[model samples]
Target chain A: MSDSPVQRLFAEPGLEWRSVSPKLTIERRLPLLGLLLFGLALLAFGRFVAEQSEAAGADLTGALFSGLAAAALVGAVVGWFFVVPRVVSAWRYAEREQDLLVSRGRLVRRLTVIPYGRMQVIEVSANPVSARLGIATVTLVTASASTDARIPGVPVDVAQELRDRLAAKGEALTAGL
Target chain B: MSATDAAPAAATQASASASTLRRLHPLTPFFRSWQLVGALAASGFGVFRDDLDKLKWIWRALHGDVEVSLLMRAVGVLLLVALALVFVSWLSWRVTGFAIITDASPSGTLLYHRGLIVRQRSQVRLNRVQSVDVNQPFLPRLCGLAAVRLDMAAGEGASVNLAYLRRQDAWALRAEILRHTAVARSRPTAATDSTEGAGGELIAEISTARMVQANLLDGVVAWVVLVVWVVALVVGGVVFGWRGLVTVAPGIVPVTVGIAVQLRRQVASMMRDANFRLRRTPTGIQTSSGLTSTINRTIDLDRIQGVRLEEPYLWRRLGWARVGVDIAGASDQSHHGASLMPVADRRDAVALIAEVTGARLDEAAVVPAGAQARWLDPWVARHLGVELLDRGAVTRWGRWRRTQFFVPYARVQSVSARQGPVQRRLGLATVYLDMPSGVQRWQAQHRDMAEAAALVGELAGQARLHRAPLRRLEPTLGTGDR
Candidate 1:
């Protein structure tokens, strides 16, 4: 790192950056488990078809089907064991005095900031799987198409509170209009 | 017989009587209904011609001779359709009318009412009027008429339009409205009557010679023609060998010429503003331009959320740049109305920038990023730098197309510091400033991590101070003034 005094002067200004709940990791992994089951089912179906084809003396078709199914199964295993954990760990958000910042993505990281005054709507949503996992997602709708920000894997109660706070703040800020 | 005694009596008499409602020009319905007339005529002719052919065929089968009755029926049908079209146009002309009502209250609310079936009555307080536009389409221009569009700060149904007025009438009405708005805002109007002074003091203008040079420098036609010709040659050679080249060779010339012509036309349309002028007024800046349909728009000073100074690759060597602003009420994504200066020299560009944004242009020193900063953005590192001013911040970045962004402390909606995995390893971070909605993306990527952190804190504090609502003192009224 460059030790220029200019750089050192601006380092770490004592602001807390908040991470999401730890239980979000388990909630994210649950989808991968379902994906693994689907892949295995697909492999079983392909093998059954291959066995029938072989009995009918179509050896080439049987080999082709078996090879394709094996590749899919391998892809599913690697994705579940490798990609999910890293992506979930990268997800983080923090609420500042006037805006909310959400940053995610491991390789092509993107950071989106949405100001409280610009927000037109705040929504809290939960699907069956996420509801069972006790997690929800909060979405912010702004006038600009590009500034929409969403926070996923938030605890259910926290999502509601966040939505209420954001809506109230947005109202207070735009009251000047 | 005193003048003051007669003025109060006349004011009361006018207010007691109903305001007059004005109708558009008699030719307005003809202009508005021409599209419908043309569509009906075409469809009517097509259907009648087909039916005539079928009737002739039937006549031949039954009587062993084609009949003239079929042609007569077709003519009758065409005439009936034309009559229906004229009737609809008459109804539309009769129903559409607009009125400007001056309310009795001191605030002077202007009520604009217009429509055919569902009436739309919009009340605009004089102080809320931001700008006015006078547009003349090709057909309307032929008849020396124009439409006036009023832009206000209110939400849905805020825009009030008065269409199909004489061009001179439109200008007079615009001036009258502006005069009332100025008075409402407590601004003096002694010099506002002068035509040249209406646009305020001149800041810049695009010369004809400079325009031609800029067009050539843009190279839009060259790039398009080259891409088309190269693609044709490569595809022909790869797919069909020597024979393919021979076959496609004849089409290459026409295709290249067609692309060049289309691109040239597009460039001309974009540069149609013959005398592009920018001026500064007391309340804001006004820009007027266009060769045929002149557009004069005024942007209030406080409405400008952000400004972007761009030096594209072609113009960089010539020291030319363009400036655009994000205005509060402008909802159009094309940003045609947001152009501050289409093209100018670096010196003038910087001067205009300083005029719009209170921050100084040359205060920021260029701080180069370390070589390792290339991991995040390869093209951005060489030119990336940020200057934090007392009241705002300016960030410069990009290689081929350099950009300098200015965001005032009060306008900045949010600030974020980002450190990706690669950036974390390199001890660098990217900082972004979220301006109010409608402004494009503004960010400084690949900066030293420490500096990025310091920027966030400093910007946040400054923003809070500037964002605090200023208490306005009420104007004290004198007993004798009223």
Candidate 2:
């Protein structure tokens, strides 16, 4: 079937809205993983002290080391199930023709919109992983930092195109003003 | 005199003749009077501990427990002496000279310089100044000095601190900046609006008790501390039995109580410091606070990029919401960061939103029509495969009040959805709507992904519509798709 005018126009734009890179997802979740590690460490320390007092033959130092390893495994599993998703949600963004939207939170979602005409600056950010993955983030800034909109996970080429187009549009808007 | 007209002429005077820099207080070098001597001493001592441990063998040799190692003993003594000298020198330097060079400008467009062997100078402009934070640590206070911190938006650090200001200069400087920012924002046109004001009569006086009550009611830090203490007590009992609990309980109880008391006082002072005056300016609404030092922030409604209303569960009970504005040309922390409207009742938040955005949120509480039609396809296409709860399961929109809304895309200023690995695997998405505050905002999340996107688009359209009047008219036809 031939593509409709609307669909064709949006096909290129829709590529702009695809999910963020999986690596970006992992990088953002490191903090949550750190927290999980801390919790597991605490759990292991408790378990080790208890085991040391209870066991007669086992060396206390050896038991403590084993407890830490066990705790880390449990923490990774629990964190993967519970915390990783929350972190991922907080670092997500979306793009559209008229504006850019950025949001975070699984339960309480906060979306910030930056109108194309209202954009004061557009920042194209890409880490080494994102660069390798061919994805970059387009951060659309309005007068307010809180209102800055980010569209993450766009193809590097698409992000560059969006930046050029938006910059042109922003210049026109400022010129009119 | 209008504050702008009174801006100090100090910038024009640039004579290298020491007279300009000399007038600055001698103690300006200590701008960061943050326990420099103590910090250095602690760090030096920390390094010395490892060296001391290595020198233990030398001590044994010196005592003839091992063959007398004269070389090792000599090196250890010399190292200790050098460390001790560095510590004393640092302490002496910390107590010595520091100075603040100020221009007549209220923003203190001056240079703050200090240090004997290493001289450092920082130039601050009035317009570059964002916020000034005045902090007094125990030592500086005991020494009758107030640390003046200037938070510049463009600066890389937390703030530029003038180690010790004669307290009087700090107050004058703060007042000067407040007056300057206010006047700078208020041109003749705004000044006229402020004085002729239909809005100035309605003053919101937040009773000190109300401020205190709100903070105490919403605070969970005290409870957390109490829980930690109880847990520690239980752990102590489990580990050392009765004897451990007895020894730890006394120390823990007093310390916890002391912390709680300190927290309460800090909260109370924080509340006491909370003061805001909203007035009509040529640009938009002017919000000034008496936090630590006075701060004046003028938000141009035309320039306001977005608005956010965040109310944590605890704050819901206190009948309060925090309002943040994305303002251009403001500091990263307050303007770009977060400008919190500390403890405002719902009506006040609504009024402030209306006044700031020039959008009446209270007038039309319901969402505009057309959710089922036009934008539905794009909405569904946007949210397809994302996991979403059926709208039936989603609860209250606003934290305190259970005001549900049926927002459409035309009213939405922005819409975005996010997913994690699990959500991605489940093909689920969580979407959010950025709407003008008040009844137009939903108290809860939309169960349908398509519906959320449509609502976001709806608000975005309205925001664009609002900007139509402000857009300048040009003779040239700007870039268009046609």
Candidate 3:
């Protein structure tokens, strides 16, 4: 039960990976749901424009556009609802003796290991939607800006606790930059 | 040299002097604002339409010269603007000053303040200095003046620029800071590294002729451009009829000229790298070179994140290569900053990379990209691969210009291994070693899936080994633990 599917899939024998709360599924995918609506609205707009134009085969044009758009919409629905949850489920972190490991994504997987001493700052915040869902996101900034390290949809208390612990560890293991 | 002291030992004893606020050269205003004044004069009255109108009204009231020529009025406005700029520059220079805040610590802090009204102040700890350099632009050099650029560790676009110091004073300041840093670090051997008027032991030197020759003969890209252009012409002629190809043939002139311009630029940079010399300092390497605007660059050995050697195909036969280094906080906007060796013997370039990163390429350990990687870039992927050493990782990639980058484990911010759907199908992945921004990043591209995974793990393990291992994070090893 402790082993995430991602940990088992990308197995490093001794490392024990910790997955985020299952609630992240809803929190991560809500914006995608909005994106899906936006796509539908764009399709409708295309059909409206097609109907208004005096071009030949306007209905045909509308049908062809709608068909491609509908197909894309269906594919997105499958990806957002089905493929995305699995990716979210795969999201995990492991705090080793010296460094922290964060791995996520399914089709194009990424695992980043950043040293505790390299952490410059740690931030924990929650938007209204996430706050209502009782969760917050923790972001870690290091001297190198591009090494993305974020743990999303952790319970608010858990996020705060993790941030404090990380800051303490970073201070205790302070290495000159 | 007349008023300012030039003795290295005296400078060291003074220790950048916490007691006195040293001002910039009196001619600093003239040198700094000349470019601004010239720009305003060139723009004439075109720059500020409203200001010009106001100036005209003031002139009509004061001079009562409605008969003044338009050109004369424009020239008058330009002269006024230039004068104002010069005045502002002088005032700003008067306010701009720096002093050592505390020499109590072996490694002290320098406080710099500038601006007449807005007034900005920043302090840089000597111990945190990544590197320092003396940059003398053409005008400043003519004036016997120089600017010192001090780079600090983990600086967020913040660097100390002390402009228009007398040349001796600049060198004295450099020596003082280096001595202070060495004293603070308890490295007595490094204390005598920066002596005024003396460069470190010369490691390598590139003659002006050799630099000009190598840069001008920089092939591969130039040749490729020619071949590709010819091929385009021929292919177009065959496909679209000779007449049509002729119609589009004029396009080739621009492309050809563009390539010529690129070659000219290479020659121009060669002039910049003229008399390129590399010396081994106690703390790092110092490069001093220039034809007109000379630059003296020092790169801290400990702050070196990545190093690369570039061997153009044409240079390969000539046994010439160039070495580049990425130092944290070292400015790379100018080609002069990152370049360690613009032109050197191939063996010397290799040795330079080894000296900096403590890693050398081993033919046995090199994992070359397989034919599968040919899909990446037919010209480049065949030569692409990575070599892992105890001290760092060496990534070799590039087509006609073979580049090898060494990223030491100590400076790696993070390790990442990623595989796309195609890479997954191909059983390959790319591993990236993250470094500070504005520097070249290293990647082990097109490695076997398992090898990539192992490489990531190995890198992470090596990175931890370089630093002190922390106490374990978990107490009870709850649900997250096995």
Candidate 4:
């Protein structure tokens, strides 16, 4: 914790960075739940096809695929309990005087600082689960394709506010790409 | 042209008034179909080669041993094919035309119409044009004709090539197009350069000897390795005889064929331009080169985002280097067409880049990738590092070619720092300075994590400073042109 590079990289003195809503964890895991359901359906479909072809002799292939599917299901459950929380916690952003700084990721830390003038567009989106959870995703589009500056798990109203503020700042500093 | 920046209030009326489209020169079809005619003739000769063996058929026909009707039939067929090709080319030329139109935007648009039945149209905003070139292919040059190629700020296939314009008309069109581009086309850069005078200064001219030397040096390393490989194989063949030759034949065939193909390609590209010359022009920098079919290109200084200087190991002793640029506008399909100088003295090349783009070249200021990076790059790590300049940034790398890239901040599209798990454990990261697509990439690989992180803000800040004053600086100069 003391030697965290994310803190070292973006920790401007007296800066209080804004952290996204923690309820984001539940909304993020819904994808894993949907994936788990799809995997079960696929497993059953595979077995049904194997049974239709030869019934008895396909046991080895069936068991192998079943084992792989089971392992993946277990991994997803574990990530739902563990990985999702940390990733959701990692979404932090700070509005600077001239730029907006966003940082995420625990193991592979990512810090992106986009100048207000460089912003081409700001998009706020939400999935059904995210809508229910009152959370939205904010993406900052720049001329550079690789910017990939998106802050997820933001409170819906706050996301809208962030968009307006960013758009206003961008207009104020308006430099064309 | 003043109407280009005029208000968008009369957009409809402007486009209507400029609706009159102009066609290319009347000889467009003849000149454009010359290559097709040549191919048809070669194939005809190849097909009738047996009958025309040493002109025996000619002697036989004269004595009436051969039928004249058969010869007439073949000649008629050949004539029919050539005529059809010319007709098709003529149709296309008739359908193709261009017009300059101003729409709802403050900037003007170039409308190109082509295709006979389908009738396709493409509109390009005049402001996005990066560079314009006047190209005269050999046959066209002989006919006193040229092609105007406009490179936009878009990606691949972004070049709009209008061919077979009269030579002087091509130049006039290029000048007319530039007048509406983003640079405002008013003034040239400050002439604090060696060649003196304002613009049209002869910066560098690649001589025949230097061109040959640079080409040979480019392949010297690969040629040496290939020679050594062949020698070792020969020694093995001698020791092992027939059995060895058979076993090695498979490897030998592909390697030999591959080297030959690569060498041929290198030679062709190297000889593409014979007398390369770089000159300062009123609107930007002008580069004219080629043995036949002279090509004249103007690259606006404002559109240049980065410059790359490459010095091969063999070229180092001769103090020769190649300079290329990353344009803010759309890059050509093959960036080889974007070189400022094919081969020039290192000192002169450096001075030219500084004079034009104001990119300072100070190798000592760059900090090298630390000793630990040897585990990754081994040889090039020592050469890899980055330095920040007030106006731009410079990065040095490449083990053999020794490439140095100078990216001015104003042209930087984005800056990013990335670290994988291994780099994280080692406290290292790589930072890349993003430019427009199709440009050569520039980055500092495996540097101290802290330094790379600091660079993210610092690099972006430098861009802000450089681009702060004015985005519409007409003919932007290097010493804070605003």
Candidate 5:
């Protein structure tokens, strides 16, 4: 597989680097699962409408039903195969001396950097499935709930260790500085 | 007089000793247990119904054939009641404990105890305390008991609850906290020798006139929205189920009346809670909500990310303005800077603007210069894109309100540029310059794209300058006082 080119690229200036477990496929692909579920729901709704139209003894031919079915199938297929991998590959974290950087998104690149010392909390949360898979999520809460940044799919052990380290480091920085 | 005073003092001591303040409510566990059991029973009904329905047992229970099972059901219910009572009573007995331990050492802390079966202790230190909130529910007011919550800056979900405190004790504790925090901030120490001296700034309290401004929506926009919502609901009901008029009449009228009553109560409560006061410590200025549970927030003057003043069509007619601040605090409920004022009086706005920016608005200053006029005048002209024909000029004073404000450019912490579809179509954008304090929210509306971009660039430069390296400031100056 020509050793994924992603592993060779290094971070540039103004970027901090953090690593998420490469093995965390299921956890990292959660958004894909959500898309899949939505597509399936839409498909079912379209089919139900089609059946209702037929039972009413009318030649209920509508573009909406067909269009929705096609859209659902396309969404399901694309999300499952194409979007998930691209999203995971682009996902990276960087813990700089100044800020914690999280960069992701395939087409529209989004890079969020929150200054480290200003971080209010480092909360480590793990679901049972994630724990079984040896991954945990770390949410770095700022004063604002809406803008809080979470880095999920981190290896469970590393996540906990990072949480403790960040909490201690952040508090010390505030107290000492 | 001495003998009579002694007798009265002894009687008073006896009565005070007999007071229940030292004791925890015995029904604490009962209330908890009742809530738990009620929730469980309601859920159980939903869970167990599937199997019972499959076997048609529910149908049998509803008919006369239930006679045979009636005795068993009655016995079962009685047993459940008895079990519930025993469990709740025992838990209440075990969990109920109340003790207020006040420690006046340098640590300055308060201790609270409650619970019978499962005892709980909440320890709150004075230094960690951010604010003390006392709430009086209808029942608590009648009982002369209030729920006091101490919010600490330790992070989220870090509050010590003194569930039931006498009204007097709650007030006393709040006052004590305020005094202690104030003393700690003002006190100086060698370690904190680097900070600058305190700058005196006046923050106007919410006067009755201000309160009226804050609730100006009572007669205008609020009523219109409410009426529209009610009308919509009634129309929907009539269209959907007009055949069920007789049965629906009983439900709709009461529901509508209940909604109206609830709205009235909400408005009244919000008005009562519309108190605003500026709280300042050595660290920074904080303008937070008072009186109401919905809008409580504390924003450090330095951390304000953006500010905007909104004057809707109706508000403009009413000579009012609403100010909103954007802070790091979770913006959903609290810490979202938004408030109403009946009259945007220049003096009041100027005073608020001064407190936030650490600069005074000098009266008789040249138009939009020296202090606020310098930045605000150009800010309004360049950013607001005021045409000569347009009355919304660079001047701080509005035609109706005649209020003026002078906010400095350097105090701005953040600037936001936003343009909606309509604004884009109109070739206009809105610019917001956020100040760290609760005042000096400068909004320039309907600016041309070029002007907005230029303002954004200028504000960005100012923000960068203001955001100096924390290390540059002497840490000792701000610390040892506490």
Candidate 6:
């Protein structure tokens, strides 16, 4: 059976796709895991201090403190082990002749399209943790306030290349306008 | 004043007059003081009323009698406030002034000087004038005065405003400025002659019944009232039993009724003139609207970025729609600047869109999205698609309320394509046409990824091909026919 016009229009015509660096996943997970461990240690230290105060005959409410700390520790552990990996895996970006596409989200997915001509600025930045992990984020700024398109967890070299290409394309395209 | 000598003499007179800075209407200070009086009345009544009540309670509690002197003091304070307000209004009126100076340049630069103490002076090149907004607030309207605000193509802070001018003077200034700045490049002399023939021709008039229906169906009152009523009933019933509903009923009724009345009045005021008129001249499309304070806005055809056709849910059922446009430098942040036709049938809307965009709706072929798009946008799949035209692209989408955007190749700021995780899995992508107006209508979603990529590439090429340098039309020699 022939496909309907709607099906034909939206049917996948597989094109060459470029994937981000696989090492980005490890880079994204390290900081999150570190933060989680740090938070757990802080909470444990607080609970210990509260218990020590209770032992010294002051009503320090050790039970309630410990319960809150345990709950937060559980939440941190879940976020570190579960949420971070999924979000990092979902991050993907593709460059076309005229525009750049960035998609990221686990459940409620969102895709942003940023054209080279519309990009007022293309910036690549890395924080201390990401730099240590050899990853950087690329941000595309436009005239509209709402559409802030950013692709995180790309290798530093890839981020720099994308920024330069986008900037060059933007300059070339904007000259006509 | 001979026909030959009259020209130079008039020019000299205009220059001489322009050199002298002038003050605003003497009554401007009084108009500005309206807020002061309102503030005084509210605070005075509130504070004095409470003070008097407290005093009476104290007297009754201690000596079982209240003195009348406290009431006299409150009255005296109220009178004093009124006197102070009048004095301030006078001072403000004395300081405010405006002047329009024709600079000694070929482009006819207009230097606008205004302000009381700080004295602000801004210059607007006559050719750069994009549109003029004539505003008359309640007091100014009653006093037969109006304010003229000139919107320029240069970014923000470029607009010049002259307030509290005689209504006739305001109209004259608008015409004179338009005439001075009118750039007739390719048009024949006959077109320029028609500009002075008469005012605009009435195109469409919104009926009172339609206005009321639009107001009610515009989703401001009906949905809000329904949601609030339901939430109130459910929550009140749960919290305080049947008596809770009864207690909330009286309060809700008065508030809802008050809001409904206010909303109706606001809609009515917005559609005061009710007539959507358009006039074509050598320079641009001229329009006048509003009942209380008539606004005259001029839309230069060259400055128009794109046009939008919208059908709200209720209006869609009735086959009614509205048309608006995105003009460069026009303050479209509010609905006032972009409004072309407030309400019309689909046919009329299409006609108006064609008139503005130079593209007929029927001429373009509509292509629906893929069947798999139903999974992504279940409500919009059938209605959403892109229409490729020779000169531009038109995209339509929405379930309850549909919107069609006409973006010409020359006006498209950028083109982009996106594919999310689900879209990647489904092989679908969304294409965006970033326009100058930042409106959401210019997007085509849920197309095949390859098709979207192809469309983006084609659109970019077309944009480059159609890109024309913006040129200001030179004033035609000897066409001073106006």
Calculate each model's fnat, 2 decimals.
Answer: 0.21, 0.13, 0.52, 0.27, 0.01, 0.15
Q: Which stretches of candidate 2 lie over 4 Å from their true place?
A: A1-114, A118-166, A175-177, B1-18, B22-34, B40-120, B132-149, B155-159, B175-211, B220-241, B244-363, B366-415, B419-429, B432-444, B462-482
Q: What TM-scores do the predictions have?
A: 0.75, 0.49, 0.81, 0.82, 0.49, 0.72
Candidate closer to the true structure by TM-score (higher is better), 3 or 4: 4
> Can you give the lDDT of residue B273 in candidate 6?
41
Worst 10 residues of 2 chain A by lDDT: A4-13
How would you encode candidate 1's per-residue C-alpha lDDT over B370-439 as one tens digit per residue? Answer: 5678776776777888777776778888687787878777666555566667776787777777654556
User: How does model 6 score by TM-score?
Assistant: 0.72
- Tens digit per residue, CA lDDT, model 3, B1-482: 11221232234445544346679999999987888866765675565564778666756856855556765786698688778888999999878888864433335667687888998766665766767899899988998999998886545477788998999889888888787666556565454455643567888888777887787677447657767877988898889888996676688678879988876776668667987778888877888888889989887777677788888888989898888877665556422238888988888777778777677755437888755777756678878988888888889988878888887776677787776777766767788887766556678888876667667878877876675321111111111111
Angstrom error at residue B237, model 1: 16
Error of 4 at A54 (Å): 10
Quote the positional error of residue B86 for candidate 2 in Å.
14
Q: What are the per-residue Cα lDDT tens digits for candidate 5 across B406-452?
A: 33443333344445555544445555554333344555555555555
The per-candidate TM-score of the B chain, in the order shown, comes to 0.77, 0.50, 0.79, 0.80, 0.51, 0.77
User: What tens digits encode model 1's per-residue C-alpha lDDT throughout A2-36?
Assistant: 45522332222233445566666677767667766
**Per-residue lDDT tens digits of candidate 6, residues B44-72?**
66876867977566556456365657556
The lDDT-based order of candidates, best leading, equals 3, 4, 1, 6, 5, 2
Q: Which regions of candidate 5 fall more than 4 Å away from where they truly are?
A: A1-77, A80-97, A119-177, B1-105, B134-147, B154-157, B161-168, B182-219, B225-266, B269-310, B323-347, B356-482
User: Against the true structure, candidate 2 has what lDDT?
Assistant: 0.49
Enumerate residue pairs that collide in model 4.
Answer: B152-B330, B153-B330, B200-B280
lDDT score, candidate 4: 0.74
- Candidate 3 displacement at residue B205 in angstroms: 1.3
- Model 3 earns a TM-score of 0.81
* Model 1 whole-model lDDT (C-alpha atoms): 0.66
Can you tell me the DockQ of model 1?
0.17
Identify the CAPRI category of the predicted complex in candidate 5. Answer: incorrect
Candidate 3 residue-wise lDDT, A59-84, digit = tens = 78788778867876886788777987
lDDT of 2 by residue, B1-482 (tens): 12332223334334223444523233443433334545755886787687887557656766778755666676687677666656654554443432333334332354554455565555554444445444455445555556556655444362566655655555455445444444433433322433312423334545556666666655556757767877877887888897876766677678978877967776655643466555555445555455444444444454454455455456666667656664323334532234536567867875676555544443443332223221323333322221112111111233232222233222233334333334333323344444432212322222233444444455455545444422212211221111
Off by over 4 Å in 6: A1-34, A49-177, B1-19, B52-83, B102-129, B152-160, B179-197, B200-202, B206-246, B250-273, B312-319, B327-337, B420-426, B469-482
Interface RMSD of each: 6.4, 7.8, 6.1, 3.1, 10.2, 6.3
Candidates in order: C-alpha RMSD to true structure: 8.2, 14.0, 8.5, 5.9, 14.2, 8.6
